[model samples]
Target: MELIFLGTGAGIPSPERNVTAVALALNEERGTFWLFDCGEATQHQIMRSPLKLSRLEYIFITHLHGDHIYGLPGLLSSRSYHGGTTPLTIFGPAGLARFIETSLQVSGSHLDYELRIEELQEGVIFEDEQFTISCARLEHRIDSYGYRIVEHDLPGRLDRDRLIADGILPGPIYQQIKLSKEPIAYEGRLLDPKRYVGPDIPGRKLAILGDTRPAPNALQLAQTVDVLVHEATFAEAEAELARRYYHTTTRQAAEIAAQAGAGELILTHFSSRYNREDLAWLIQEASRYHKPVYAAYDGYQHPIPRK
Candidate 1:
């Protein structure tokens, strides 16, 4: 899985960055990508990146803030001109359905694909065989939410080399050995599948949070996750301003990641006030509290490897 940052600036767009939009590319795992918070000009950003609008399967909106959702109607409309025929589902806080419906209605825009809008509640919103997505309320000015995505554990690989060494040549029996829960008769002998399989591979966990101040739920959502994507809207020197604005500072984001035991922390949603040159200082402040912390810029890509 990989995270592609289409836009990373906070509130408004700047020459160096756009607004907040992130694409979670799962082409290898699921054959499609999920979007988090489509901000203003997000489609424009996607056009510049390697992502395709036709492959967008899910969209999770953190809040109804204009910077977080202004591009939704336009992107949805444009997807029709592309090859987006598959059904699309959008999960977000209350009032999202009205916004999208009103925008499409007023603009006389129509989509060729099925569009499903689900107003989010603070719990597990989606669950299938492969993954489970849960949300928790965040401490933002609006009813913002943070999402926790947990990929289901995968079955262990068959020890093909060991089987070959044991003179069990590759055949239909190998498939039978891997699928059998109990011992299967293999060449007049019972063989246990567990003995030929490796340990179960652990699933990857990711927590992508919306703009907010430090909250307990944030730590719970991000606990022991492979990656924690949080917002650092201000520098540590502007801690008071951050609190007043219901946003987090660089140091505060790192502290949360460290406290949550996250493997890595990626900070985004930077204020336009800080230009490209000031990012190094922000990373320095965050690194004092946590190792392997990154401040994401527009078009930045971070890969999450399987454990």
Candidate 2:
């Protein structure tokens, strides 16, 4: 899977960064992409990348803040125009449904595809055979959520060479032996699937958090994640200001990653005041506690590997 950061600024757009939006491309895993947030002009950013809006299957809004969700109506309408006929589901706080529906209604917009908006709570929001998504409350100015996306363990490759060596030819019998629950007869010999199948391969985990201060839920959701995307809206010198504004400082975000034992950390949602050159100190401060910490930029792609 790959993570594409569409916008990485906080509150407002800047020359270096836009706002909060991330695309988790699951084309290989599920043949689709899942968006984390849709800030203003997010569709414009997607246009500049290799991502396709038609592959979007889910949109998980962190909160109802303007910086986090202003592009929902426009993106939704544009998706229909772009020939996206599959049903799309959105998960967010209680007010998200009203905001999107009201915006679409006021603009007299009509979509050709079905749109499903769900008000989220602190629990598992979605699950399929491939992945499971769960949410937890975060400490922010308004009600916010952090999402944990866990991929299911995949079965290992079948030993075709071993089966062939054991007087078994490649045919429908191989399919039956692999899928059957009980012992299968192959040329008057019973074969067990356990002997031919390799061990189960572990999947990857990712944690994406919304605008928030330091909280235990953040660490819990990010535990042992392959990548932890957290908001670091202020530098260490602005700790007081960050606390007053209900945002996290560079040091606090790093602390969360270190405590959670995350494999890697990508910091985003930077304040507009800090330019690209000014972001080095933030990364330095965060890296003091955790190694391999990175500051995200718009259009940056981070590919995650299975653990």
Candidate 3:
């Protein structure tokens, strides 16, 4: 999996940055891409990146803020024209459905595919064979939430040497051993499936937070995450302003990362005032407490390696 930042600026699009939009590309794992937020002109930003809109399967919005959902109508309408017949699902807080419906109706946009929406609350947001998504509300101006994506424990890999030593050549049987429950019988004895398994491999985890101040729930949700994507709308010196606006600063974000013991901290949703050079200062301030703090910019893709 990899995270591609289509737009990392906050509130408005800048010459150097766009609004907030993040894409988690899992094409190799599931041939699908999941989006975190769709800021204004998100589709236009996606056009310049290596990501494919056709592969988008899920859109998770953290809140109903205008900067987050402004691009939904255009993206959905364009999806139909781009041959996106596959079903799509969107999960977010209440009023999300109303916003989409009103926007589509007023803009005369129609999609030729299945569109599903889920108004969510604090709990398990999503789950599958490989991952489980956890969410909790954050302290923001309005109702908002933070999301945690915890990957499930993966089964052990097949021991090819053990199979070959047992006179089992490479064929459909090996494929079955790697993927399913259909076991093969060898020399009148049924070989157990577990014998051909190697060591178990653990999966990685990621956390995505919306516009909010530092809260205990946010810290708990991001605990030990492989990658923690938090918002740094201001620097350390702007703590008063940040709290007054119900947002977080660089230092507060770093403290959250340190408190949660996250392996890596990625700070996005920057204020429009700071330039790319100022972004480095934000990272440095964050790194004082947490190592490897990444400041995101438009079109910057950070690969999440399978460990």
Candidate 4:
């Protein structure tokens, strides 16, 4: 899994950044992409990247804020125009379902594929064979939410060497070993997969959230995540103003990352007040408490995800 920051600025688009939208590219894992926050002109950002909008399996909106969801109607409409047949599911705070339907209706937009929208509460919202998603309320001016995505554990790899030593060749039996419920008789002996298989690999977890102030609930959603994409709208120097605006400072986000034990941190939704040269300092400020703190810009891609 990787995080591709499409629009990382806060509130408005700038030459240095777009708005708040992130692409969780799990193409290698599930042959698809997941997005967080479809900010204004977010579809424009995707056009500049290798992302295929038709492959978007899910979209999670942080809140009803314009910068967080204004691009939904356009993106969804574009998906249909591009001949996308895959059904898309959108999860967001209360009223998101109405927002999309209303916007499409007002514009007379028609879609070819299924467009599903769900306004979420503070609990589990989505799950499938690959991942389970949950949300918790965040401390924002509006009813914002933090999302947690947990990937399901995969089966252990079969031990080809053990099977080869027992006069058995690798073939469909290896497949059976990976999916076996009990020991199977291979050749003349009963082969116990538990004895020869490698340890089961646990699925990686990712947490992504939008604009919000420092909250313990955010930490709960982000606990032990491989990646924590958070809204760091201000520098540490503007903590008071950040609180007033219901946003987080770089230091506050770092504290949240540390408390949650996140392996890596990607800070987005930066205020336009800071320049490109100042982003290094902003990241350094967050790196004080957490290593590998990244100050995201539009088109920036992070390939590593912690488990």
TM-score of each candidate structure, all chains considered together: 0.96, 0.96, 0.94, 0.96
Angstrom error of the Cα, residue 238, model 1: value is 0.7
**Candidate 2 colliding pairs:** none
Model 2: CA > 4 A from native: 172-188
Q: Which lDDT tens digits does candidate 3 get at residues 1-307?
A: 9999988887888899888899999877899899999999999988898877888899999988888888899999998987899999999999999999888899888888999999898899789898899789999988888999987766679988888998888888776676654466766878677788755578889999999999999899889999999999999999999999989999899899999989889999999999998877889999998988999988888988867
Q: Where is model 1 more than 4 Å wrong at Cα?
A: 165-167, 179-189
Q: Which lDDT values do the candidates have, in the order given?
A: 0.95, 0.92, 0.89, 0.88
lDDT of 2 by residue, 1-307 (tens): 9999999999999988998999999888889899999999999998999888888999999988999999899999999888899999999999998999999999999998999999998989999998999999999989999999999987666899998898787898777766655788777788888788777678899999999999999999999998999999999989999999999999999999999999899999999999989778889999998978989999899999775
Candidate 1 lDDT (Cα, 0 to 1): 0.95
Clashing pairs in 4: none
Model 4, position 76: C-alpha lDDT score: 95
When summed lDDT is taken over every stretch of 10 residues in candidate 2, the lowest stretch is: 173-182
Error of 2 at 276 (Å): 1.3
Q: List the residue pairs that clash in candidate 3.
A: none
How do the candidates rank by lDDT, highest first? 1, 2, 3, 4
RMSD of each: 1.5, 1.6, 1.9, 1.5
What TM-score would you give candidate 4 relative to the actual structure?
0.96
Best by lDDT: 1
